[model samples]
Target: TTGNISFRNETTFGGSGTVTYRWLVNNVQVATSTDLNYNFTVPTGATMPYMFTVKLEASNIVGCKTVQEKTVQFNPFPRALFNVVQARGCAPFNLQIGNQSTNADQYEWYLDGTLVSTLHSPNNIVLNDFDRTYTLRLLVKNQYGCIQDEQSVQVSTYPYLKAEFDVANDLSCNGILDVQITNRSVGATTYTWDYGDGSPVYVGNNPSHSYGRQGVFTLKLTASNGFCSDIFTKTVSVSNTPSASFTSNVRSGCNQLIVRFRNTSINATEYLWDFGDGAFSREENPEHQYAFANTAFTVKLTVVNQYGCRDEVSATNFIAVSPPPQANIEVAPARVIKVPNYSFTFKAVTTDDIILYRWDFGDGTSSDRSEVTHKYDRFGTYKVKLFITNRNNCTSVIEEEVI
Candidate 1:
């Protein structure tokens, strides 16, 4: 601080005609010129409220001397001091500043090299730069412009963390459930996982796990950077296995056999049937026709679920089909028979095995034999019929006319 001092009155009391003026500060001479104004500067590194004495002496050739003295007080310099509650924390760090400066009349605060506040003790200072440092400064000045001081501190911050992940295989079937995980997180250094299946918690990234049973489960992942953490969750579903089974109305029949199949499968969503006769079907319950005679055929069934798990069953030689006997009638002794005592021989012929034969004459007489001789009482024209049955109870008939 500096100031100018002057002896205002130019006239000296009881002095000689010509006067010499001398100025002294703190008992040391600074100027001896006739100019009354003196420029005074406080010494460097002077404390606040510094006091000094300014004196002036008037002397002439007559040897008369007079002295005038005055004391001066300067304004105090301000001391700027402060403390922060916390200097380092996670992102969006909150700060509580305490102002403990002395002899200060004005205050200025700067954050990250930008002036932000002028209050002596500002509240609610928040910093949002992640993983970086900033400078917080405080400047204080006295009321009279004597001096000003400033203090600064370094504010540090940690990074903001996020947790993210994905399930590669969330679905399974056939009583087997296996899961795969993928990590896709940002600003994270550590990881934790929970499969939510009554198992131990896992600690790592991208882990594979298997469940013992079929059901739905929840999955959780936590990511951390040692100072902050985040959490993410998901759900998974599993299904049961499939079993194939079926039943038929009949196993064996004559030619042109028709069969009805009934399906009884567990945990099956789809069905396929192979009738072993160069035929196939996809219906759950189906009816089939077998046309090959005197032949046996096998049947098979396959079932599948939504998860692409499948099971198959086959019944070998499950159906038997038989051919009916084709009957032929032959009458001997000529086409015309004599009246009274006319005897005609009847014969039945077939390629298949015959269990029984029946013969019906036009004269109301019938016989149950492969060949028979019949005598008609009276007949102008007559029709003879033959019926043959195979071992499978399948029958065929033929008729012939005689005169």
Candidate 2:
């Protein structure tokens, strides 16, 4: 199609007379008028090398004629056409767009009236969310001028499916876990589960599961809604119960007996000890002392694991402490004995298990017996010393003077 064409006369003949115009295309008279404007359609399939020409002739009343010619070259306007590929189902909608315009040198893409890309063909335009509408536009232009042709399309989008779940009662005793799962997902029609413990796969919205061993397990849940699918995972922990037991170095001893305690508890991290003598300890293994004699003490051990599982063991009257030996000395010789070689009998009187008795006669002589007879050769106020020991390796001593 050809647009309008105009001609102007700028001749000045001292004051221009009446002017006439004639327009011709390719030596053929096409229009004749006194006005300066003409409009016509250029014939299609015109060859190159100036095959068509337009000429304008102007004349005044003085019989002067002037002619002008211009070679016509036709360039058709660009047509903007495009094809859109719309993805209906899913959260991230992928769109493929292609430009099919003729004689286009540049292109622009718009989404929802906002400029997105400047390319001939743009692919994978992603959109998220559900029940939304978007407007896509393609603007194409040629290298001739600033003219542009545009085309728009409206696309409907939907959301993709997802899966999510949470677990309860994951911790249990003796490697038995009764797990209860809760599903919290949207846009899903089917669900599947992988318990990660070599167990059978489960298919449902919410399912109860059981584990046979104590360990950390990974739980997986997948949801699908025919068009898309998603997966969610979590970790669960199971603990082993703790066993509490202990041993002592010595169960019965004398006073001030230092007892060494050994803890034999399994799967225990923390320990508490009660020595039953108003004493306590937090160490795993400890040594304790019994201060008073003839006393019985009950010892207790409490253990705990990482999962807050606790166990306790106690031995009633597990320790016995005996008193030390006491030494009592007596002599049957009077202080006023006039005889120089008088014999004196010594004895020990105390409630204790006497293992040995040591007697010093104050004459550079010693003896080991409970009762002893010592003759004083010279009775000049002799001092006697007695030492006694018990079965608990405890000892005591006493002293007296004799004449």
Candidate 3:
């Protein structure tokens, strides 16, 4: 008669009766009991005069019942709460951490996939490194010795990406280093590349690249769907190759001019020369003789590479030629008639250039006076125009009149 009631109950039998029980808290009915234990939450207060009363009732065949009440003290201690603050870095070094419950008793840590440590305070903690998974958890026990729930997340990191290689040092080549890519994100599904050569190049691990010119480069690595990326730069030393030189000259002799071409291409296999004289020749060293006087000239060279690639260069050159004297003109038909038309002949003689001539008839019409005739449509008085040019580019002109 002085204890809390429960279902699995034991009591001393006194009289013949049907036994049942109902429980109440804060003076309100909450549960029915037929055994020793009765379920009910204690009214919330430690100092308050809260009570849990167990009732014993008895009934006989006469339909008459009698009851008695018993009560005991009900008290429960408050529970403590614990949580994790942050988890970072790789396993073993995962550094599992959490804040201790203000009145807590102990701490524990798990990393990657395993539990490794238990401590008494909220200090820095390291977890197990034996697992390959990227997630880990923390555990804390309150003053009442209650364990905390688990917390986890996935991390992206690569510890194997250390690089090693040498630089390229070629004059005619793109100066790229012999570097390599390594898959350090353990258990990664795929790999990507950015060779820092102006484009995103994709290849498997240990990939190599060549640059277009000479300079420093910034290389980058992005792995695991861009989950992690790293950048580093390196300077490459490159040198310039000197270009070969070419020179051509012209010399004059009796009735002939000799043209000469030369160069300093030790790597070239063949050379072509365009003398600008409407003539061309192919040889390492070339010589051409011309009987014509000095004229405008352009000397060209086509240097053929070992790979058959050719580069052509041309230089303009001028020559000094002797000009012939101008010829004297003679009018054959000194007089002519026609109010509206006249015809006459004119001639000139030049010993050096006989085929080159100009004619100036007394009429207003004229022609190259080598031995030319002209007619004037309106001939009251007329003046003529004559022009002549020789192969040496020497020119002579004459004008005449008739009435």
Candidate 4:
């Protein structure tokens, strides 16, 4: 800071004996001289824009004196200094600021080249957006219209981590439970997985796992970005399957055959038996009867478990039924001599076990014999009919002519 002084000297006499000048600041004399030029510098560490009362005194040898006074104002430049409470944090971060400026009448703040606050001391600034870096600037201006250099600070932000996942092949059959896990987390660098089967923990973005047993299980996933971590969980269900098998007591018999079935299935709660002969049963052990002879029947057994898993077993030609015997007869003399009495010998031909037979000569005569000799009184023509029955109560009939 600099100040200047100007003074004029006057004398009544043309030739002056002596002329003296005196200058004082704030009512204190500091210089005495004959020269008209006066200059001084302000002291350091003094208050800015200081006011001073400067006086100039002029004296001649005749003792004539004059005095002049003026007031001068001095101002200094401002100093800018500040600090941020926190420079780096996660999103939605709050930052406290401190202003330590000197000789400043107003303050202005800028963030990322945009003005944010103008107060001398601003409130806490919150940054809720994600960015790699942010620039904060502060400007201080003094009453002298002099502005300080811009002061700046840099703040860093870390990315937020989220955990999410999905499961594939969750439902399985035949007691084989295999699952594929997919990770859907964002802004993560590492992952950890828990399958919830008392097994070892796994670490990966995607993985496949097999369960030793069947039931419901819970899975967990954790993701981290070295600064923040998040977790997610899900529930999965597994089903148990059953094995079906069966046995039968009788495989082949005569018509109207009765067969007993035994069910042999594992992990089953319900059963269904289908006998190929248009018969169905729900009993674990059931009895079925076949009515058609000379026919083969297929048997099927299906079992279901508590988890709604099912299995089936089938046997082709599991049961066979046979028909009763058929009877036929042949006579040695089909046509006997047309005399008063003729005798014919008849023999029974059969394919099955016959227990009883009845023979009629068609001439009002009958006999019960497998092989017999029949005598006909009238010899024009005679029809012989035979009926036979098997041990199973199945019967057959045949007719022959004797002439």
Candidate 5:
């Protein structure tokens, strides 16, 4: 490195003709000229100050002379260097600059070609834009008001985050309320979930959860990437559980009853019926056959909804079936009776459970008795029919000929 120095002579010589000048540094003469001002260059020492004694002598053609002496010193040029704490970070980023300049007495800081600070070290610098880059420059000067060196660095900002999540509006199925969460955030590295069903908070990208009961609930998710955070919220719902109920067209009958069942289930998607006679059906509404007689049956219904919730109902002794009575007719006289003896007795020898009876003599006369005797006016043969009914409204008939 090198520096410049200048010397001036302010001397007066009387009676002078063609005055000459002599310039010397450290007692060594360097130039002998008539010039009053002299400019010189010298090497800058390593981390040390350099001092020189400058002398000037003036003489004319006469034997008259004048001399002046001065001491000069040269300081080293300043070198500017700095480092940025963070080159790139998320939005609203704080910037830190470390000043590593040498031999500087004054400092000037510039951001994006604009002077921001003149102190040796600036403080509290922050950048608030996303996906942008900025330039920072440092200018340093020595005590001589000489700005000789400059340093610059770049600071960049990362993109901001937009947090979002997606889930089904209705999470009910078969009866159970299960939810699936999807993270749809941009520029996020972590996630949090609040199911709002009095459950524990969840952490991760996507998760599966089940609610203890069915109703409406609030859902929330938060996404973060160490620079920014975002939140999403939604209202979700769950359906009710299934209830089982049923009805029948006829609850009781006799002799191979065929019953038609009607389903009245609520919030159900599937149904099962147990006829209690070793028969089952999976239809919503089913008709079952009861081929056995004199039997009482217990029916059951089971229902399930889309969320897999189930319910069941049982009807104890829901149906009753009875056997028909056996009908028989008997006459005191033989089947072949003589003319004018056309009187006969009819009897209901049916099952003892009989409740009522009917007799048709085939001669335009009738009787409503368990046993009856009737007479024919003509000598022709006649048919006598006997009908019997039991407690369960079951009927049977028998016929006999009389002459």
Candidate 6:
């Protein structure tokens, strides 16, 4: 902040007024400006623990002058960086991490997720980046006695087999079931995923499987690079039916929209929401606004149980944030859409010089014009949605069918 800090001062000539200006870097005799204003420039490379002093000297007469000083500082202790993952050689959290520059000696390591580095260390600790979380504290000696600097490595959770059992790894889902596991963890090999059925596959970490019948089963996975095993589980309640429900939308005052969920979960405390705004909401209940009118949005939710297992649910008509009357929505056939495949258009009713139009077709594919033309991508039926709006700022939906 050394550039130019401009300000004006007024003094009632008590015995003739006069003001002198002086600029000093680190309190050294730098310069003296004749005018009331000055352009001050402090030398760069002055990092933490450094100061810039600017003083204004005012004299009221014979050797009677008062001085006022202001000090400024830049670049306080470098910000903390944290990122830990399951994979080896993975980058630090957000890749902003680097070697500590605070010149320290003692280092401590902690596990089990974040902060709370319970164990203290006095040596250069070689970290195991495969765990859930790893944070370190470096005890450096300076003017500040044994200062501690910390960094974290978020080990990637990418799975080696693509699919992991949430209950028993060595478990089953019964009947015809497909399992989807995420691959973000780092450093893993040879995933032995068991569907607890008649057969198991030896492939990637997240793979789909099927069972011959419905009953109590165990799921398991043995992954290794010949060094150690990283296992994860779930209990199968395999019946003839799978039940779950998506959350409903809430309307708040001041045109605010609050959305929440009531799931059909056996056990869960975590959830992920895709509000369809290109922006995602992250709680069981989230609030948003409809600043823009006539918008349409698609929302998705996934819940995780205490067993470290997660699943996502997608419904065709989950959310609806549309644009500001860019297009109109309309349904065709006016009744039912036949299974298999069909196509249709969404039209706007009023003129108001309607500039544009968009159609959600509701079957997953939408038309992007004032009058859209679309068809069903797969067999079966859909609630084909057509949203319509006029240039004058009015919105409405027309639902129909294509059998």
Q: Which segments of candidate 1 are over 4 A away from where they belong?
A: 1-174, 180-203, 216-240, 335-341, 362-364
TM-scores for all predictions:
0.49, 0.50, 0.28, 0.42, 0.45, 0.25
The global C-alpha lDDT for each of the candidates, from Candidate 1 onward, is 0.84, 0.81, 0.51, 0.81, 0.80, 0.49
Give the lowest summed-lDDT range of ten residues in model 5. 40-49
**What is the number of backbone collisions in each predicted candidate, taken in the order shown?**
0, 1, 12, 2, 10, 69
Candidate 4 backbone clash number: 2
Put down candidate 1 lDDT per residue, 1-403, tens digits, no spaces. Answer: 6777666646456633888888888998978875557666778888867788978888877878888888887776788999998888877788789999988989999998798889889886788878889899999998778668999999888876778988887777656677878899899999999888889999987888998777778889989998877899988767776889999999888889999999999988899999999999999999999999889898999999876668899999999998877877767877687767688888886677898888878778899999888877775788888888888877777899888
TM-score of 6: 0.25
Write one digit per residue (lDDT tens) for candidate 5, span 141-207. 8886554799888988888787787776455634456777677889889888888988899889888
Instruction: Give the Cα-based TM-score of candidate 5 against the true structure.
Output: 0.45
Positional deviation of 144 in candidate 3, in angstroms? Answer: 5.5
For residues 247-269, could you state the per-residue lDDT of candidate 2 as single tens digits?
A: 98899888899999999999999
lDDT of 6: 0.49
Which window of 10 residues has the lowest lDDT sum in candidate 1? 7-16
Q: Model 6: per-residue lDDT, tens digit, 226-248?
A: 55556655545343333234656
Best by TM-score: 2
Q: Candidate 5's error at 224, in angstroms?
A: 13
- Clash pairs (backbone) in predicted model 4: 49-74, 335-403
How high is the lDDT of residue 79 in model 1? Answer: 88
Better of 1 and 4 by lDDT: 1
Name the lDDT of candidate 1: 0.84
**Deviating ranges (above 4 Å) for candidate 2:** 1-168, 182-204, 218-236, 305-308, 334-343, 376-384, 391-393, 400-403
Q: Between the candidate structures 1 and 6, which one is better when assessed by TM-score? A: 1
